[model samples]
Every structure is written in C-alpha cells, then in structure tokens.
Target chain A: MILLSLLGISILVALIMAFIGDWRFAPEVNIGGSLLTFIVSLVLALQVYHEGGSISGSTYFFVDYLNISLVVLTTLVSTTTAVFSRRYMRVEREHGRVGHWRMRFYHAMFQLFIFAMLIALVTNNFGVLWISMELATLATVLLVSLYRTPTAIEAAWKYFILCGVGIAQALFGTVLLYFAAERVLGAGGNALLWTNLSRVCAQLDPTVMRLAFVFLMVGYGTKAGLVPLHNWLPDAHSEGPTPVSAVLSGLLLNIALYALIRCKALVDGSLGSGFAGNIMMGFGLFSLLTAAFSMLRQKDIKRLFAYSSIEHMGIATFAFGLGGPIATFGGVLHMIVHSLAKSATFFSVGHAAQMHGTQEMAHIRGLIRGNPAVGWGMFLGVMALAGMPPFGIFTSEFLILTATMKDAPYLAPLLLLGLTVAFAALFRKVQPMVAGLIPSGQKQLSAANIPVFLHLALVLILGIYLPGFLANWFHLAVEILK
Target chain B: MAHTLAAQINSLLAALILLSAFALLAQRKIMGLVHIFAWQGFFLALSTAVIGFASGEHHLYISSLLTLGMKVFLLPYILYSLVHKLKIHRDIEAVVNIPTTMLLGIVLVVFSYHLTAPIRELSNLMTRSTLAVALATVMLGLLMMVTRRHAVTQILGFLAMENGLFFAATSATYGMPMVVELGVALDLLIAAFIFGIFFFHINTTFDSLDVDQMAKLKETD
Candidate 1:
C-alpha cells in the first residue's frame, strides 16, 4: 500500500511541479520526486518478500505478483526516464528546437502520461482501465503532435482516428464482457472487476469468453503496435519527442500486452488453452514476420527501433501463447529487458538526432567517432536489441526458443527463422550509422544520459546473472499466469 | 394491447429512420443533406424516447433528450450556419453520381436487414423489427459518408451514423446509460465545432470544400 501510494503520488507531485512554471526546476522536481517514489517502492518490495505473497486492497486496487511486477517496471522506468528527460529536454531547449511554454506543456503532459499509465495498471475495474488507456492515448497523441508540423499533425490525426476506433471496439468488447459476466454473477459491478472475473472465470461461458478475446486482441493489438495494425507506431515514434517514443515502445506497449494477457488468461482458463493459443500464436507469428521484414527497408532511425519493438512484443506474445512455466517466465523477462534496452536505444537515438540534425540514416555516420558515449551506447543498445549473446534479450529469447523446441517443436523453427530475420534486418540498418565515417555535423556535448547507461548496465548484469529473488518472483508470477 | 401499441410505435419510428437514410442518400443539395441528417436525428431521439418510456428506464429518457439536443437541434444548426458561412449551398460533388448512389444505398438497406435478422430475433419485443431498420439506417448513413466528397456531406454522414447507433442501442438494449449518452453527445458537438473549424481552414487553404483537394496535401514523391 505504501509503495502504491508513492507510485501514484509521484505522478501527482510531478504534475504539481510541472505546473510550478519555473522551467528549469520543474523537471528536476519531477525527477527527484519519482526517484523518491522509486526508493519507497523498493522498500515495499523488500517488505513483500518478508511477508511472502499477497497484500491486496479493500477496493479498486490489488498488489498481487502480476500487477506488482508491472508497477515496479512502470515506476522504475518512468522515474529513470523522468531523470533522463531533464537532461534531454534541457539539451533541446539550449538548441532552440523548443520554447518555454512548450517545455511546460511537455512536462505537464509527461507527468499526466505517467499518471494515466499507473491508473491503467492499478485499476481493478475494466471500465476505469478502458478510460485510463484512453487518457494515455490522448496524452500521447498531444505529445506526438508537439512539433505541430504537417507531418506530425498527420501522424497524430492518423493515430487519433485509428486508435479512437480501436479503443471504441475495446469499449464495446468490454461492455460485452460485462454482459457475459452479468448473467453469471448477477451483476451490480463485480462482473466488471478483474480479480472477481478471474476468480469466477471457470463459471463464465467459454463461447462468450472466446469471442471477447478476439475483440480484446484486435483492440489492444492496435495499441500494442502489432503490424497490419501497427501503422501508427512507426509514424508516432518517428514524429514524436524521443522520450515519448521510449515510453510508448517500452511502457505503453507493455501495458497493452498486460491487458491482453489478462484477457488471454480469462479465455485460456475458461475455454482451455488450445483455442486461445492458436489465435495468439497466429497473430504473434504474423507480427514477428511482418516486423522482421519491415525493419529491412526502414531508413528513419526511430522507425527502425519502432519495428524492433513490435518484433520483441511478438516474441513476448509467442512465449506466453506457447503456455508453459519457462515460456511465460521468459516472456516476462523479455518484457523487462526489452523495455530497458529499447528505452536506452531511444535515449541514444534522441541524442543522435540532436547531433545529426536529421532522423535519416543517410545523414548520420560513425557515431563512435562522433561521440563514443552515445555512439557506443546506441551500438550496445542495438546489440542488446538484436538479441546478442550476454544480454538479457538473448537469455529470454533463448529460454523461449528452448521451451518451444521442447514442447511445440513446430513453433521452434518459426521462432528461429523470425529471430534470424530480425537480427539481420536490425544489423543491416544498424551497421552503417554505428561504424561508418562521421558525416557533417559539429560534435556536441555528449551527456548520453546516466539513467539510460544505468539501465543498459542493469540489463547486461541481469543477462549474466538473474538475481535469485527476482527469478523467484518471476517464477511465482508465471505460476499465477498458469 | 399495450405490447401491440409499443410495437407499432417502434416500427413507425424505425421506418422514419430508414426513410431518412434513403432521403439522405438521394438528397443532392448539401443543405438538403443537412436537413435530412437533422431529420434522422429527430427520428432517433423519438425512437429512443419511446423505448425509454416503454422500458421504464429513466436513464434512457435522459439519453433521448441528449440525443435530441445535440444530434438534431444543435448539430444541424451548427452545420447550417457553417454551410452559410462557407457559402457552400451548391450540390456536393457526390463520389458517385446520384442515381448510382441511390442504387447502392438500396443495396446497403437490403444488406443491413440481412445483417440484423438474427439480432432482431432476440431483440426487445417492441423493438424486434426495428433492428433491421436501425441496421439499414446505419448502412445508409455509411453510404452517405462514402459517396460524398464534400467535407460538410461527410459530417452529415457521420452524424447520421451516430443516429443509427443511437437507434440501434434503443432497439437492442433500450439505450446506453445516460452518462455515456451525454458524454457522447458532448463529444459529437465538440467534434462538430473542431471539424467545422478544420473545414474552414481547409477551404481557405485549398479554395474548395471538396476533400478530393486535400488529397493533393497527401505525400507524393
């Protein structure tokens, strides 16, 4: 409860500070507040360990392994990114790319974005969750169009219309789920509660549950940036502020997946595994293959990373869909690793964009020669993203491949093929910028953010050594998934 | 006797909704399109109000009032003013010529009735046949959007589509909660204002209200 309070209040405090109207200290205040919140959450995690399993709420909140794990990821990344954006945004201001009021607007929207994500994660009610996700989408839409150029506006408009329709579908699907549960539970509002639904999931009609999953997946999948529906992701990422791209890929995508996984649990639990798994596997493979090939032709830097995010999400979905302890655990680890690595990649990409004056690969060259910290950091981030050995993605991907190979031998080949295709595609785009001769741009002050570096380091360390306690928690969480 | 009265009223309202969809499709003048759209909204509000009274759900009553105020009264008024302000009384450049659009609109009505057949079976007894009518209104509204190139015509189509959705809710479930209805009503009104301003901007930029001109704004190598 203390951790939850801190996590929730950090956003409030950040919101308060952003409105303080002193541009310099507002971001600092936000960062410091989130850091304090992080420390508090860490303490609460330790206490949870001491008590051993389950500390739920009276109403509208829960702290089971599933959400508690997600909260930790969300808050930790959010705090780090807040600290990172202070430096990142200040650099932009110094460069004259953005103005003071716009800075305030950015800070305000940033805090609100975090607040929305927290609400979506913690809210037990499906209606509240739907509303929170809408809030998040709206906040990010504003951020995506911050530049207000024709292209940015076009991107934001496309995002708004498509996602508006998608969220409406989710809304109708949610109403249907309520209708499905209402008859069984004799509903007031308990029919709409996640915990309550999970508890009585077995009693619900399988046919209704199965149909609901289709709506939930297609609806949430649009937000998750799954290809065919992923048209918005690359554009939004390419066009938006970089910190937002980081959060969208790292946090927002995960949030959508988390929602789907919750829905998947309901469907899987009710109808048995095979029915849901078949569709999940199909969508996952389709997304992975599409992203793999899509990355091959990409020239825009942020867009390249956007496709990689999709590929990783596909891997995570494939893992959970494969349905085993090892696979589910692997999926969770991949979620965490990819979040950290990809955020770091964006941080570097943000810096590289600042340095190069353009997002085009043709315009950027020899990042290492230009600024070793950001250059090497981007290279390392790319290496990690491409699932290189001795990185967290590698461990997670390996676990997934191994688990699939052992259980569903047919899926293993597809997984391997997709992985190889992704690796090649990423490297093909990555090599030119990271290794070539420096193009024409003045070398700027390199403050490749310390938090981003810290994130990369933590991922590298975890790849080499999964902390015993964290592993235990993931395993326990996987058990909960089952 | 009461059930028969309720069924007759619902069937009448549904018929009005379907007829307006046809009128919207066949209407040539943009001003006529706006008028037909307002008429559709009027039918929707009437149907929902009737459903609310029949069902005894007070929220449905509140929703019907909102549907009336926004969709029928305020929205049409705004569109009329926008039409006048933009001096856009000329016939909209229909994406398909009028006769073909009407033919297609008829096809959509038939298709909608087919689509709503199963739904009609499990529907509220009073609203049984209205399901097909509501679906037909929805398809006709969609047809209005598709075959119209003018921004004002497209807005008419969108509003008409909402009228269909409102009618569907009434026919299927007696209506969505009052709060949701009000929220959507507010959203529609606000959207109309925003889109109207956008239309004005588009007109000034391109010197035409036709969306085909905006295609030139799209990316080209």
Candidate 2:
C-alpha cells in the first residue's frame, strides 16, 4: 500500500503541476512531493531490513533486498536534486534564460521522469520495465532539449535515435525471452513475469535465451552508458541542465544497470555457461579504458564529470562481471558511493559554472578565491571520486580491485591502469582550477551549498563506518545476484 | 490439401514483403520512399491476417488491424504532412549508392536465412518458413537506416524495422501478448509524434534536414 501511494502521489502531483501553469508554486509542489517520496522510500528500506526478505504487493509490485536498496538510493538522490534545482532554476530564471512556461515544463517533466524510474524499479513484469524505461527516456529527452539550442537539439536527437534503436533490440530480445519461457510456462501473464520466469529459468531454451541475452545486453547497455553504445551519454549529460545531468549520472545510469542485472540473472540461470559474464567483462574493460583516456581531452566541466561517470559505471560493470560474492558486494557498494559523490560534484559544478559565467574549464580559474565553498566542495567530491582514502568510493574501489586480483590477476593490471590514468587526469585538471590565481573579472555569487555538503558528509560517513543495516543489505543483494 | 495451400500463400506473402523491403532501398525520391513504405505495411498487414486466420490465433487478428491502422493509414499520413511542412526536397539523400544498398540487402537476406536455418529445422509452426524473411527485413531496415543521410529516411527505416519485428513475433511465437502489442503500437504513435516535432526543430535550427549539418557538438581539445 505504501509503494502504491508513492507511485500514485508522484504521478498525481506531476499531472497537477503540468496543468497548474503557475511557476511560483511548482517548485514547492516538486520539492514537497519528492520529500514525501523519499521518506516513504526510507520506510520501505527499513521494512525490508527488519523483515529480511522480499515483500510482495500484488502481482505488479514487489520489493526485495536487491531493489529496495536501489529504491532508497534513487529517492535520496531525487530528493536532493529537487532541493538543488530550487536554487539552481531560480538563478536560471533571474538571468531570463528560463521563463515561467519553461519552469513549469521542467517541474512537470522532472516529476514524470522520477515516476518512470520508480515504475521501472517496482514492476514485476519485464514488459512493463521496458515500457517504463522508454517513458524515462522520452521524459529525459524533453528535459535535455529544454534549452532548445542547436547543440541541445542535436544532443537530444542523437540520444533519441541511438537509444531508440538500442531499446528496440531490447524489445525483440524480450519477445524472444517470452518465447523461451512460453514453451515451459505456457502463454499468459505468468510467462512474462520476472518472479515466474526466474523460477523456471533453468528450463528455458538455451539457444533462444543466448540470442535474447545478446540483444538485452546491447539494448540495456546503451542506456547504462557502456561504451561502443555510449555515444550519446557525454553529449546528453553536458547539454542538459546541471541538475538533470546529476540525475542522469547519479540515478538514471544506475537504474539502467539495475535493469541489465535483472536480465543477467535470468540469462545466467538459463545458460550456466558463463558467456554472459565474459561478454560483460569485455565491455566493461573497454568502456573503462575508453572513458579514462577520453577524460584527458575534456574542456567542458560537465563533460569531464560525465566521462568520469562512464569510467565508474565501467568499474561497476566489471566488478559484477567478475561474479564472486566479494565482487558483487563491491559492485553494489560502488554504485551507492558513486551516486552520492557524482551528484555532489555536479551540484558544485553547477554553481561554479554560474559563478565563472562559463562552462569552459580554462576560464574558470581560482575557484577557491572567487568562492571557497564551491571550490572546496568540488575538490572534495573529485577526491572521493578519485578513490582517495577516508571516502566511500575508495573503499568500494579497493574492494573491487582486490577481488579482481584474486580472481583474474591479468585483468587487475588493466583496472589499475585505467584508475591511475583517470585519477591523474582529474587531479591535473582540478588542481589549477581550485588553487590558481583568481581569473580576471570574476564575481562571487552566493549560492546554496546544503545539498552538496549533505551528500559529501554522507559519503564521508560511509567511508569511515558503513552502517550494519546497509552492509547487510549489500550482502543480501550480492547473494540475490549469484 | 488445406495445409499445403495455406503454406503456399504464406510463402508468397512473405516474398512480397521481402520485395517491398528491397524496393524501399532502391527508391531515390522521398515521396516514392513513403509510397513504398505504405505498400510494405499493406503487405505486412495482409501477411499477418493470413497467418492469424490459418493458425486460428484470435489475438493476431487484432494485431493485424493495429498494423493496418497505424502503419498503413496513420504514420504514413503523418510523415506525408511532415515532409510537406518541412518543404523537403524530392531527392532522398543516400550515404551509399542505390546498387550497393540493394546488394547489401540481398546479402543480408542470405545471411538471415543461414542464421535461421537451425531454428527453422527445430520449429513445426506453419509460419516457420517465413522466419528468415522476417529477420532479413529487419536487417534490411537497419541497412537502410545506416545508408540514409536524411532524417525522414532514417525515421522511415526505423518504422520499417518495427514492422519487421512485429512480423517476426507473429511468425516465431504467434505474436507477443496482446497487451504488449497494444503498448508497442501506442509507443510507435508517440514516437512518430515526437519525431515530427523534432524534424521541425532540426530544420529551423540547422536550416537543413540533413543530419550531417547538425554535427556541431564534437569533442573539443
């Protein structure tokens, strides 16, 4: 009942905001609704923690240790984004860059995007998952092009076409999955349900499931921002509103990976050949290398962080592909920490861009002099992201690296190579920005840093001492994956 | 006798569908491509109805009606108006020449047949033989998308690819669940509307419908 209300209230508020046409009240509604949803998510997470297993609510909705963790993560980040956008969008509006109508549209569509992602998370049916994911894509496409610049439109266009094609392949793969399951479960709703399909996963036709897994990998992998299929990620991230970029890096990519892992569970159960893991490992390493190298050439601050997201996703994917209890645990932990640190980075970047009056890294010099809070916030976030000690990201990356060394010794060197290059590239770029002489004609702008500091503080606490309940959740999630 | 007759008609319809895919690749005019696309949708709807009738799957009847309503009547009409509004030129810009694309289409048909041979051997459904045709049509649509420089042609190719997937589902597994079918149909309609809006924006911003002109977002050093 709580889950249903959460989804329901989100959609209802979205519709209300969409039709209200009053920009003044839109942010309040957006923030209020998202806060309530976040509280509900925390309640659900506690329920799962104490109850210690799957909680079923009818046929369409269910919560388990695996997804409850993601549900909580998603809601937390979304609530922060809502708070962050309040200050950010106001600044945008004051500059006449955003009018009343655009603000209303942004508020409405932002809520809808959250609703779509929550729907994707809660649905028991794979078909519904695909539909919700498409909804998420469409909603974000609109948000990405909100500026309506030539470049923004170009970014939105590429995003729609590439992801549209990739998702179509996923649909075909889903049909193939249904076909494989239908032979055993017979035709009906039960044939497509994840719970029923996973129950009978072993009996599915291997050949058909093999083909279907390939399609699902390519399809969902595109959305997850895996390279070779990730041509749209950087462009979409850099061009959209900074808060939207934070959501994309912190939440949407994670949701896509969650979907892919769900499919991977089914495919692994059916084949037992380890082919899925091998393919994932191959893609993961390639993406890690590609993203790490590409970061060296980035001039746009947002694009730099966007490439870092690709690198982190690559590491998470590689960890999961390694497929041990330790590796899975590390992967799950990495996802949580990455979302926190990356969103904080974007929040700081948003304020920094606003202060410097440009997104070009070359022009935004001496951030510590112009504004200490934004400069230090970005520096700490980047340090956490670079896997420095006493940060949550370091703990997760360390675990991932150790697990890789234990299982695939040869691959560990490549992982090290990617991480070192990425770390160096980020440091070289950020050092000058944070510590250099203040650039000429720079003006300091007072902006809210509450969300940024809040995220970083949580990440810091996670690094020092992970809560017992959260650790237990990660372990349970890993077991579910195996 | 009835089984043989139904199989013969299914084979003939499948052939016509494949021929239409080829014709779409060969056409050089935007208006001509739209016409060929409509014809392909017509053959797809006909093939689907025939297969549904022969197999006695009642929901496929509804599926065929959807294909007819959306593909044959609605989408083509929308595309037609989109072209008119954009004042698009008649020439359908191709990144690759006509003969080469046609040749690639043929090669894809051969590859799909080779790929589906084992699956065909395993299945006993009446629509089994058309599985290769369905796959080939999908591949050809992808090829068309890769070879076209114009936004309209790429959209056409995408729709054509959806048509192929629908046919594949009907032939391979007697179509997806009715709910999924309806949802996909709705998605197609929504995507078309979105693309229509996008086309106008692209034209106004870049002053050309050629996608190559919108390549201003490159990685900077």
Candidate 3:
C-alpha cells in the first residue's frame, strides 16, 4: 500500500506542480516534493528486508537486492542534483540564458526522468523495462538539448543516435530472448517475465541464448559507456547543464550497467558463467585502457572527469567480470562510491565552471585561491576517484585487485596499469586548475556548495567504514552480479 | 511447379533489395536518397509479404504493414518536408568516392552472407535465406553513415539501418510482437521529428547541415 502511495504521491506532486506553474515558486515546490520522494524512497529501501527473500506485489514492481540499491542511489543523487539545480537554474534565469517557460519544463521533465528510472528499476517484465529505458532516452535527450545552443543540440542528437542504436540493439536482444524463452514455455506474454525466463533457462536453446547475450551486451554496453561506444559520453557531459551531467555520469550509467548485470545473471544461471565474464573482462579492460589514455588528452575540465567516469565504470565492469564473491562485492561498492564521488565532483565543478567563466582547463587558474570550498571539493573528489587511501574507492579497488590476483592473476597488472595511468593523467590536468594563480574575471561563488560537501562526506565515512547492514547486502547482491 | 514458384519469388525478392541498394549507393540528392529509401522500404515490405505468403506465418503480415506505414509512406514524407523546409535540395557528395563505396558495399554483402549462412541454417524460417540480405542492408546503412556528408543523409542511413534490423527480425523469427512493432514504429516517428528539428537548428546555427564541418567544434585537437 505504501509503495503504491509513494508512486501516487510523486505523480500527484508533479501534476500539481505542472498545473500551478507559478513562475517564482517552481523550484521550491519541486525541491520540496523531491525531498519528500527521497524520504519515501529511504523508507522503501528499509522495507526491503534481505532475510525475507524479497518482497513483490502481483504487479511488475518489486524490490530486489539489485534494484533497491539502484533506487536508493538514484534518489539520493537526484535529490542532490535537484538542490544544485535550484541554484544553477536561478543563475541561468538571472543571466537570461533560460526564461521562465523552459525552466518549468526542465523541472517537470527532471521529475519524470527520475520516475521513469525508478519504474525501470522495479519492472519485472522485459518489455516494460525497454519502454522505461526508452522513456529515459527521450527525457534525457530533451534535457541535453535544453540550452538551444548549436553545440548542445548537436550533442543531444549524437547522444540520441548512440543511445538509440544501443537500445534498439537491446530491443533485438530482448526479442531474441523472448523467442528463445517462448519455445521452451510454448508461447505468449509471460515469456518476457524475468522469473519465468530464469526458471526455464536450462531448457532453452543454447544457440539463441548465445546470440541473445551478444546483442544484450552490445546494446547495454553502448549505454554503459564501454570504450569504442563512449563517444557520446564526454560531449553530452560538457554541453549540458552540470547537474544533468552529474546525474548522467553518476546515476543513468549505473542503471544501464544494472540492466546488463540482470541479463548477465540470467545468462550465467544458464551457461555457467565463463563466456559472459570473459567478454565483460575483455570489454572492461579495453574501456579502462582507452578511457585512461583518453583522459591524458582532455582539454575541458568536466570532459576530463567524464572520461574518468568511463574509466571507473570500466573498473567496476572488470570487477563484476572477475565474478568471485570478493570481486562482485567490490564492484557494487565501487558503484556506490563512484556515484557519490562523481556527482559531488560535478556539483563542485559546475560552480567552479560558473565562477571561472569557462570549462577550458587552460583558462581557469588557481581554483584554491579563488574559492576554497569548491576547490577543495574538486581536490577531495579527484583524490577519491584516484583510488587513494581513506576513501571508499581505494578499499573497493583493493578488494577487486586482490580477488583478481587470486582467481585471474594474469589480468591483475592490466587492472593496476589502467588505474595508475588514469591517476597520473587526472592529476596532471587537475594541478593547474586547482593550485595555480587565480585567474581574472572570477565571478562570485553562487551555486549551493552544500550538496557537494554532503556527498563527499558520505563517501568519506564509507571509505573509512561501511555500515554492517549495507556491507552484508552488497555481499548478497554480489552473487547475482556474477 | 510449386518449388519453381517459391524459388522464383525468393530470387525476385533478392533482386529487388539489391537493386534498391544499388540505387541508394548511387543516389546523391537528399531528396533522391529519401525516395530510394522509401523504395527500399517498398521492397522490404514486398519481400516480407511474399515470405509470409510462401511460409504461411500470419505475423509477417503485420510486420509488412508496419514496414509500409512507418517506412515507405511516413518516414519519406517526413524527410522530404524536413529537407524542403530546410531548403537543402542539392546533391550531397560522398566523403568516399562512389565507386569505392559501391565496392565496399559489395564486400559487405559477401561478408554478411558468410556470417549469416550458419545462423540461417539453424532457423526453420524459409525467409532464412534472406538473412544475408538483411545483414547486408545493415552494413550498407552503416557505410552510408560513414560516406555521407549531409545530416539528412545520416538520418537516412539510420532509418535504413532500422529497415535492415526489421528485416532480420521478420525473416529470422516471423516478426516481433504487434505491441513491440507498434512501439518501434512510434519511436521511429518521434525520433525523426526530433532529428528534423535538430537539423533546422543545426542549419541555422552553422549555416549548413554538413556534419563533418561541425568537427571544428571538437575541444581537443
């Protein structure tokens, strides 16, 4: 009943906000409603008791160990992004970049985007899952192009093509899986059911499942920003509003990975796990290598960090690909830490970009000199992402490397090489942006910096120590991440 | 006689797809590409329908109608109006020489046949033989994307890729469900609208729809 109410409350709030559209009050109403939704999601997460073996209604919505984690991560980042948007948007209005009418649309669509992702997370049917992802694509495309600049429009279009093709490939894979499943169960809509498909996997034809896994990986791989498929990531990140960039990097990418992991679970249950992990490991290594080297060439600040995200996602993928209990646990932890750190990083970077008046790394100088809060935020963020001690990323990366050395010793150095290369490249670019002389024309720090601190603090505490319950949950989720 | 009829129809279907692909290869004007794309859709619809009649699977009929409506009539009409309004009615020169493109296309066709033959053997669908054609269409569309300079042509290439994918689905497995087919058709419609709007904005901003020109905006050298 509460789940239904939570859904109802979010929609009702959105509907009321849409109809009212009081120009001045839009942000406050939306922000307050978002806080309400976040609180509700927190309650929803607690409702999912791990020992009870998952709670599902007759409807497609259910709380699994996998998606409940995503739901919480998405809601937390979304709420933070919203808070940051309140300030970023107000600045846009003051600067006359966005008018009142468009702000309302952005606010509404932001809500709708979150709602779609949550729906996508909870959906048990594959068809509904595809539709939900399609919704996310449509929503984010609009957001990406919101600025109406030529570059923004082009970036949005490119993002649409890359992700559209990816999702279509995913659609083909989904249909193939459906076809394979239907042959075993002998037909109809239920063939698309996750539980039903998993139950019947042993009897399904191997050839179709093999082909279907390829399509699924390629399809979801594109969305996950795997190398060679990551062309749209940096452009979309740099051109869009920074909050959107934050969520795109931190949240949407994880949801896409979650989709692939779910499919991996099904395939592994059927085919005994070796082929799938090998492919993920191959793609992961390639992505990690490419993104690390790509970072060395980055000129724009957020673009550089966007590549870092691709790199971290690669590491997470490698961890998942390694697939023992320790590795899978590390992968999940890496995702959570990456989300907090990346979003916080972007939040700080957004403000920094505004104050410095350019995202070009060469133009901004002495970040610490001009503003200590955002400058230190970036420093801490980069540190955490670089996998240094006392941050959650270090522990996760350590766990993954140890696990890799034990099971797949040959891949261990490749993992270390990717991590170290990325670390050096990021600091090489970050030094001038942080420690040099303050550049001219620095605008006053305007956007709220609290969200950045909050995110960093959470990551800080998690690095030092994880709550026992969350660690246990991460371990259990590891089994399926295999 | 029945066997000959079946072979004749399958060969005709193959010939029609290849002819349209050839026309698409040589076609230069944005308007011309759109027209050829619609014709290619026509061939696909015809091929799927014939495969349906030959195989007696009722699902392919819906797939054919979807191909007809979304591809032949709807997408062409949208592309035509989009280019007309944008006033870019001139022939677009390919980045790669046309002959080279044509040669590359032939290689792609041969490669696709090599790839799809084994998979085709696994399926009982009689349209299985056309799987290679379907794959070639996909490859050709990708090549078109690489060769074409104009944004409209890129969009044409993307739509063509979808056409190839649809053919693959129907020929391989009788078609996706009606609901999914409908959803894809709707998505294609909306995608076209978004792309069309983007074209106008791109044209107005940079004063041309040539995608390669926008490479000037890349941040890193």
| Top model number, lDDT | 2
Sorted on TM-score, highest at the top, how do the candidates line up?
Answer: 2, 3, 1
True contacts kept of each: 0.00, 0.46, 0.19
lDDT string, candidate 3, A369-389, tens digits? 888888898999999999988
**Residue range A326-347, candidate 2, lDDT tens digits:** 8889888889999999999999
- The residue ranges of model 1 lying beyond 4 angstroms of the native Cα positions read A1-22, A36-58, B1-4, B7-49, B62-94, B97-221
Q: Is candidate 1 or candidate 2 better by lDDT?
A: 2
Badly placed stretches (over 4 Å) of model 3 are A1-22, A57-61, B1-15, B45-64, B90-96, B219-221
Q: What is the RMSD, in Å, between candidate 3 and the native fold over all Cα?
A: 2.9
Pairs that collide, model 1: none
User: DockQ, per-model, please?
Assistant: 0.19, 0.63, 0.34
**By DockQ, who's the top model here?**
2
Q: CAPRI verdict on model 2? A: medium
DockQ for candidate 3, please give it.
0.34
lDDT (Cα, 0-100) at B78 in candidate 3: 87
Candidate 3, residue A99: lDDT: 70
True contacts kept of 1: 0.00
DockQ ranking of the models: 2, 3, 1
lDDT of 1 by residue, B1-221 (tens): 76678678878878888888888877778888888888878877887777777767667777778878887888889988888898887655545577887888888778767755654553335776776676567567667765777767776776676677667656655654444455456556545655675566557666777765543223211
lDDT values, one for every candidate: 0.76, 0.87, 0.80
Inter-residue clash pairs, candidate 2: none
